[model samples]
Target: MKKDKFLFLLSKKLSNDISVEENELLTLAINTSDEYKQLADKLTKYFNQRKAKNSKTDKLRAAWTMIAKAEEENFEGTFDYAAPKSKFNIFSFLKIAAVLILALASTLVVYTLQKRSQQEIQSFNTGTTKSFKLLADGTKIWLNKNSELSYNSSFGKEKREISLQGEAYFDVVKNSAIPLFIHVGNITIEVKGTAFNVNAYSGKPYIQVALIRGLIQVSHTSDPENRILLKPNQKLIIPKALVQGNTSKFDIEPISTLDLLNETKWTSDTLIFRKEKLKDLAIRLEKKYELKIEIQSAQLKERRFSGTFTTETIKQALDGLKLSYPLTYTISNKLVIIKD
Candidate 1:
């Protein structure tokens, strides 16, 4: 059906004047097309807002006046409002006109909302601490510092999907009929009731996913034919090359118990590093402490260190690193510089 016809049916549905057949048609349209679903949501929000602002009769009158004036002026030549001839019911003509006016009002509101609202739910962890969220579908997510996750308002209805910006740990509820999809850059992770940790920080050279349990499928967005199914205790690492290219050439290895613990310890506000390079470690430090870290010497940047930090100050964490290696760091203001 055309968009205008669907809108007309939607307006009738909202007004509780739609026939059973018309309601079925609208339901089918909503289920079949994402565009229709979004339109319905916008219109529903608009009607609810109107109800909150004014009485029912006043809201209806205002909507009818506004739409009738606009249509009489802009669509004057299209609709015939003349007195009906024989066999033409005047009351039916008036009822159809009212429904068309309602649809026009809904269209105006939808257009206004589209112009102003981005229509996505965004959860961003901009502070020095991690954040947690429980989705409407009973899925739990833990977002690390300086991370972001976003999904459209229509999420979890027919399919579950979200986009990730940095890092997160997800314990998804199982629903085979509606598997979850997580998009990170050019790679997509398909999960069906799995607990996994994803590290896709923008400054990093690679994106990593460690599945603690259940199953997941990872694929390059441009090359779906090149994919990998990851089993429990498996980790998939995609370098920048594979992410930007058309192939899914990446590394898939088994994750040890300790490895899983280190990967997910950040969810508990604990930072754990195992033989991590100084340069890579600086990125985590910067995010956790909201500071700027600069490694001065090339040798110092390549130095490896291992440690676990929980409830430790930035100075203390760096001091512990110095104990493991011959390094000196100077902290001034919000900046930290490291050297040999």
Candidate 2:
């Protein structure tokens, strides 16, 4: 219903007189959404038919606003129009996506889709909160705080590929023909059916892929020929190219940490760290609680500790951390300052 108005507007803007820039935007929206003429032709006819209706201009604008919301929710499947023959409008589909990738605007849409994925890239961002999703392939993906996952709706059809940021645990359904491929920046983790935890924070200087069950292959974009295969109970970390230097902030090896279950414990609403550096632990806590953490002393940041906490309060987490490390913290709004 709302999408119709968006398509109607696009068609009207193209047929009628509109600003040159607006026309260019609509044209780009159409091209970006889909290249299939059959789908586009059906949508063009639908738009033309709807344009003749006595719809107010505000109604069209309202539909444009709804596009952003629909994009946020990533409403699955196509709209059920009154005309069963009418297909989903390519322009409207791409316009909302364009908004999301451009600046959380359409540019946000472009940024997410510009170089990666084919067409039809849908993104899920878990900002300061964990999120769960039953993907198109029936795979259960649990994204940790401050994470993102983007995949096209036709994920299970020809290919099962998804781009990831931050951390996510996947319980993938076994699909031999269409093996799943996870894209984290330059590296790709290929798996057919497996349960694993992947930590690839955009800011973190390392990427870790820990396998719980099944097998996975980790490869880098720079070195396509040399790929590392990981077995069960193992983790693979790719040292990121830092602006400062070649050194990674964390270990760059595929080591198991069952003693702490350090990778996927957040899925159970628990934060557990076994001998993790104060700086790394601080970063994880900040993301888990959605707060800014400032450690006063550089020396204190190097302290290693082991702890577990399921507390909903940041102070409680801090208290648990203090048991092992000599640290005091002050909370000011969304910021936490820790001092030695």
Every candidate's CA RMSD: 20.0, 18.3
What would the TM-score be for candidate 2 when compared with the true structure?
0.43
lDDT of 1 by residue, 265-319 (tens): 8787656566689999999988888899999999988887665665679999888
Give one digit per residue, the lDDT tens place, for model 2 in 1-340: 1223334445445334355544443443443233222233554555456556736433544566676577676754655555465477764775554333222222232334333544577787878877666564557788888998888755676788789989999999999999998998777788999999888887887777788888888776565555667788776767776222222332435455673277788887656565688899988888888889999899998887664544458988788666555688899999999999
Evaluated at residue 121, the lDDT of candidate 1 is 62
Q: Against the unseen true structure, what C-alpha lDDT does each candidate score?
A: 0.77, 0.66
> What's the true lDDT of residue 271 in model 1?
67
Per-candidate TM equals 0.46, 0.43
Name the top TM-score candidate.
Answer: 1
- The candidate that wins on lDDT is 1
